[model samples]
Target: MSGGVVTRGRERRDQQNGQNSKTTEQKRDEEQVQLAEANSLALTMRSGLQAISKEIRDLKTEMKKDLTTLKEQVTEDVKSEINDLK
Candidate 1:
């Protein structure tokens, strides 16, 4: 009877340990899933920022071209006026 009692106690302790191990594994799995999601979000935001930055650079280049053309046109008009006055 004492041997049976000891066996039963050991079995219960082993089952309790198994449950704790499973719980720890579950928490670890959840943390890993969360980390993956966070990484995905960060990548998406970085891609969006890169696209917006490219667009801004393109607009700046276009504005500079427009300014250069305008300056040339104004200089031509002034030269014409001076030649007419002479």
Candidate 2:
């Protein structure tokens, strides 16, 4: 009877270890999937930020040109008005 009890105990322990190993493997797989998704999201955000930065730079350049043209036109108009007064 003692030998039978020892064998049963060992079987139970082995079953428990197997269950723990399976659970650990499942958790590791889930963590890997989550890490991959996070990496993909980060890459998408980086690309979007880069595109927005380029658009802002282009807009700034265009605005500067428009402002310079307006300033030149205003200066010419003021000069013409002064000449007319003289």
Candidate 3:
């Protein structure tokens, strides 16, 4: 009877260990999937940010060109007005 009990106890412990190993493996797989998704999202966001940065740069260039044109026009108008007053 004593030998039988010891064998049964070992069997139960082995079963529990197997179950724990399976659970750990499942958790590792889930973590890997989540990490992959997070990396993909980060890459997508970086691409969007790059596009936005380019658009902002283009807008700045256009605004500078417009300001330069306006300054030249204003200078010409002022010169014309002074000559007419004289």
Candidate 4:
């Protein structure tokens, strides 16, 4: 009877260990999936940021050109007024 009890206990422990191993594997797989999703999101965000940066640069260039033209026009107008005064 003592030997039978010991054997049965060991069998139960082995079964429990197997179940625990399966649970741990599932958790690992879930973590990998989440990691992949996070990586994908990060890549997408980087791409979007790059696009925004390009757009901002283009806008700055256009604004600089407009400012230059306006400055030239103002300078010419001021010169004309000065000539009239003279």
lDDT of 4: 0.99
Whole-model lDDT per candidate? 0.99, 1.00, 1.00, 0.99
Against the true structure, candidate 3 reaches a TM-score of 0.85
* Ordered list by TM-score, greatest first: 2, 3, 4, 1
Count backbone overlaps in model 1: 0
TM-score of every prediction relative to native: 0.77, 0.89, 0.85, 0.85
lDDT by residue for model 4 (11-81), tens? 99999999999999999999999999999999999999999999999999999999999999999999999
Query: Which regions of candidate 4 fall more than 4 Å away from where they truly are?
Result: none
CA error at residue 39 for candidate 4, angstroms? 0.3
After superposition, which runs of candidate 3 have C-alpha atoms over 4 Å from their true positions? none
Residue by residue across 30-76, what tens digits does model 2's lDDT show? 99999999999999999999999999999999999999999999999
Local lDDT at 31 for model 3: 99
- lDDT computed for candidate 1: 0.99
The count of residue-pair clashes in candidate 3 stands at 0
TM-score of 1: 0.77
Residues 12-45 of candidate 3: C-alpha lDDT, one tens digit per residue: 9999999999999999999999999999999999
lDDT measured at residue 17 in model 1 versus the true structure, 0 to 100 = 99
**Consecutive 10-residue window with the lowest summed lDDT within model 3:** 21-30
